[model samples]
Target: MIIDESLPGKEECVGSLKNILDALYVLNGKWKLALILCLVQSSKRFNEIQNEITGISSKILAKELKDLELNDFIKRNVYPTTPVSIIYEATEYALTLKNVIGELSAWGEQHREKVKQSMRKQS
Candidate 1:
């Protein structure tokens, strides 16, 4: 990479970079995407979500759910019933991430195949 300090709107580029970092900071976690994927299908109870995502602890799921709610990615609903029922559902704001999630899923599948091919060559 050659040095090019005379570029236009360098400050704007910096701001855009900051925006990207901020978004990543909110979504940065092993579980957030998985949890979002689960909720995309339909609203689910806490235990249903916990059961759907393997290897996620109840404590971590609870924390991630709270984080998602805070970020407006999901809505938590409480229904009055014989036993208080709490459900988690994706917010319309979260649908803004649909393209990003789709692209990531595509890239992940490609990466998995690439890694498998490399492993086969090693063998």
Candidate 2:
């Protein structure tokens, strides 16, 4: 919803709209945030991440990881080892989303309860 130029708070509204669109452009997927949340707790190998974030197939996880890495939200570290061990870690930039993630989690719980209550009332 783009506000008209004559509106009192048009500048703020347009700025906010642009900012939100930019954020959504970067974080517009089901798995990106979840993957980031998982790694933010601790770095892990490919399979480990796949296991922790259930229902995310290895193929999709790989793609999501690539996207996160490209966005500088995660780091892919390669260790010198017999089988070439590698781990995915959340970058410092990713930590900035901690509060956002927390808020979303809390909101999700609240929304779930609200939905449940609404359903109960309907019956």
Which candidate has the highest lDDT of all? 2
Estimate the overall C-alpha local distance difference test score of candidate 2: 0.93
In candidate 2, which residue ranges exceed 4 Å CA deviation?
Answer: 1-8, 114-123
Clashing pairs in model 2, backbone N/Cα/C closer than 3 A:
none
lDDT, residue 80, candidate 1: 98
Alpha-carbon local distance difference test for all models: 0.92, 0.93
Return the TM-score for each candidate structure: 0.81, 0.84
> Measured by TM-score, how close is model 1 to the native structure?
0.81
Using TM-score as the measure, which candidate wins? 2
How well does model 1 score by local distance difference test? 0.92
Please give the lDDT score at residue 51 for candidate 1: 91
Tens-place lDDT per residue, model 1, 3-115, is 96666598989999999999899999999988888898899999999999999999999999999999999999999987999999999988888998999998989799887
28 in model 2: Cα distance from truth in Å?
1.2
